[model samples]
Target chain A: MSKQSLGSLLIGMLIGVAVGVYLGWVQFPVEYTNSSMQALAPRYQDEYTVMVSEGFLVDRDINAALQRLAVLGKENTPDYVQDLTERYISQSNFPAIPSMVALSEAMGRLTPLMEVYRLPPAPTPTPFPAQ
Target chain B: MARSPRARNGIRWLALLIGLVLGIGAGLLYTWEIDPVIELNTAPWQLNPAARENYVIAIALSYARNQDLTLAFDRLRAVAPDRNVWQLVADIACERHRSIQIASNSDIIVMRALEQLYRSQGATGCADGQYPTPAPIVFMTPTPTSTPIVPVGPQATKTPTPDLPTPTVPPPVATTPPTSDRFILARVQSFCDAQLDGVIEVRVFDARGQGLRGVPVQISWGGGQREQFYTGLKPGREPGYADFLMERGRSYQVSVPGLVSEPRSIEAIPCEAQRDGQTVTVTTSYWINFQQQAN
Candidate 1:
């Protein structure tokens, strides 16, 4: 091959590579269909935590709530619930405050901020005087 | 030897095409395998099968507490927009039971929550009625049977008064009788809607008009057919609400425990209703309410 032909081929290959890269990365990027809960965005993660807290209110089972929150792949589930509850309090997310506080109390993560939102205990009859 | 112009042109074109193909392959390899899109901001639908199940379970549980079907539907739509959301819940429940995932109490509750969400929406699966929701715990207040017995003690100083003070008897303490659990058929109303067809919605309430949960509601139909379902199963509605779909041309009877009135009967007769500016034929639906009799 002559020097001119070689130069032309090299230039063509370089241009082709640039087009290909543009098409591959920009025009059509890979889309993930299968992902773990840990991949959830920050907003969704907070929503899931609140849902688990509500479930805790329904069943009053801390272990179950902890297990459900485990899917988030957090290192410490209780601390996560606590921190989220505290965050909600600071942000004044009123709709979720009660359930989150109840779950935090169940997990022994209740902070002073959550204390006001604690659900009142069921009433019990007073004991009669000893005969 | 000197190459022909045409042959040289062909060779140039071939080299360019080869270069393009090679470049495209390399680009795809890098993008797909080496540095694919970063995993972030994944929507609920993109979740893996296990994660999707978890997401659905959370949605069901949230619905159970919040009793907001619209919100629940919106959330489930986020998970799978193209499919039937209620059927999706049913499938999840069936899968859990099939996979032996009901070993724990929470697992069982998860199954129940799933069933409640699906079944109440007219979706049925193998897990239907598999995990019956236990009745809510009832704590009775302790009632004193007899007055406390006070023993007579020797007086520190015995002074015999001419007339001993009349033995005083504590005035009789009036006690109200405990309320009976008897329930009576309070009202039965029939209505037809193009959206909701052939449904028998049963509601039970205490004497105070508050909805009561966990009351067994029994339904009987043709040929002595009978089925029992408990309230509060579908927490998405009122705690005392439970409903059943009725077959066309069938008469159904509903009764609750301690019901004073005879079992209420409803017929699924064809009715006319309007929908989207068009008239449609739909089966009749009834809402029967039971109230505790105040004693």
Candidate 2:
């Protein structure tokens, strides 16, 4: 291109870059800062999803739920995993939830690993079977 | 050259003007929309100090005036949106009216009335319904003694038999009637062993032994940390009744207007068992007396 045309094109590109940066950093930051709630933090979102899904499965079949949750724990701990677990336990029907014996056996499997990581054990309901 | 200098200066001025306009627009948007929306998501307990004080004041006013509690609670939630209403109310009420004096029958009546008002509004605290049936008011009147009669004839015959062993008679001890009247506040034939969960029947009477109805009596104890309990006596339970759960180690104070010669404090202690588990843990007491004339 001619030098004059090239100079004009360069000035236009500089102005566009400046305006785009300003809009992204200041003008509409709230929208950009809060991406989709699910994408806000992948670790937290994935852990919560896995825990809740496992909790539901546990309601249907204890062994299957334990297997699913074990896979989730192997991935990475999330910021709200404990909160999600508590909410799931509190919301479940007390009588319809898995028997305390089965629940504790599942938790016993994880207690040693959890202790090694200095994390609290999963809440065990009362009435465990004889060791 | 003249046009070039002027045009260059004008471009600089145009950029400065645009920057000023943008800055002002951003400030206004932040203050009006963004700040408020962010604050809305924040919890009530996290409000600034001044806002928290105002919220507490609103709760106190609502409780004192016996306003609609649910509405008061809604207003509280608006002011401090994240606090548990019941826990907040319990804490505020305990702090504001913790100490009540029940010195006279009038105080008892007024306290009972206030308690009923609180009950009607469905507010519970240290002075909830937890006292046993009020015992009958027993008025203790001094038994007057008659003057001793002079034995003239019998003494004269005794003087003639003085040679025989004389019978020595002891002079009658000077007996005076009690000047003050004592009334029964509450009595339990058997005391409560554990915590008594019921109402305490308190009877108040004037020095003349007449039942004093409509007296204001305040009952307060330790619960929720710091709150005062004020209730007036109900009509059927005259002279007055203040309902309170008597727990071990908690002391209750009763005060009455005009009749309270002095302040009365009663510690609720466990009593012996009775049928149907009706026993008194604490017999809270107070008295009113007529002012004596100066010598």
Candidate 3:
């Protein structure tokens, strides 16, 4: 119970706290092995959205595409698709633009800017006249 | 010996050690519990099971559209750095099949996409061939032509001409060939390997000699013991490659369902082979090859 011992204890405690903080935040930060889709980083989220959009192109099922996109925990799935489609349009991500536009159009989120990117309608047969 | 009084006042090392331990515990508690590291910039490998499944589904569907195997492999590698990506996809497909997740058309497409991705990569599972891929849709547009001008001459067609039936375009049909008894055994070669014992390796190929995936292979032994397996189960092997092990001194027949040729019978006879720089006795192994017959 000497003052010197107490002083030493306090100093040691302060140094330990600093070391602990450093280890916790810098050296060995907590790693997450199980994160939901919503926890994905912004870039990855955008990539996932593009993938889903591409899937929509393959399946052409708007409802299913919406259900898949819902896992991102977006407030409004249609608006999110619309915004992303427009953003891609603005950014000229051409490879992803058509699918995203198709998905947006399916979700009723197609904007004026997305009109040019809409998938061209299937060609129809031209009737022949009697020879 | 006379010593200085200052030497008698030694440091309380035990107390300081105790204080350091207590402080470390407190600090860890504050950092891990009170305000932990923010969840940001998580990689695909960190995704939970459900999220990972979704991510995999997206990848498969994307691959289906793009047919970019390299891109798909790269993306899947990011998701599973340590494991075989094709097998991962096959497991997901099997899980989906077991869960009856094909209630909707989209779900069925997802299953097909997963199968297409894995089977092409020579990975198979229980869900193999559970959902057949739909044939691609092709539109046959007729070329437009100008109307022929008919003169209004009274003598040309005074009598009413018989009405001609209008020609109609046939409905679009699936382009995939029928899956009947179209496969015939091409070659059956027996070999003995120390590493592979009493194994019947089956390889099924298309008419063009290209490997086919998802074809079921059946093996039957005494006592009516029968087992069915599909090709492409081993990612390290060819897509049409599958294998079965036979016990020594036993006879087995290998056949593909709906196969036109007779099933091949073989005996697992004993043989000598090299093993780890030493001679060892092993059972004979056979390789069965089946090729699709020309239509």
* TM-scores of chain B alone in all candidate structures, in the order given: 0.47, 0.25, 0.51
lDDT of 3 at A124: 64
Docking class of 3: medium
Candidate maximizing TM-score: 3
In model 1, where do residues sit more than 4 Å from their true spots? A122-131, B1-13, B135-295
- Compare candidates 1 and 3 on lDDT and give the better one: 3
- Candidate 3 has a DockQ of 0.51
Task: Assess every candidate by TM-score.
Answer: 0.61, 0.22, 0.65
Tell me the deviation in Å of residue B193 in model 1: 17
- What are the per-residue Cα lDDT tens digits for candidate 2 across A4-40? 4344444444555455445544565433222222222
Residues A27-107, model 3: lDDT tens digits:
887889999999998888898999998898888888888899999999998888889889888999899999999888888
The sequence of per-residue lDDT tens digits that candidate 3 reaches over residues B129-242 is 888755546655678999999977666646887999989977866555654457777667688899999999888876434578999998999889999999998879878899
Candidate 1 chain B superposition, TM-score:
0.47
Model 2 residue B256 CA deviation in Å = 20
* Greater-TM-score candidate between 1 and 3: 3
What lDDT score goes with residue B136 in model 3? 49
Instruction: Score chain A of each prediction against the true chain A by TM-score and list the results.
Output: 0.80, 0.33, 0.87
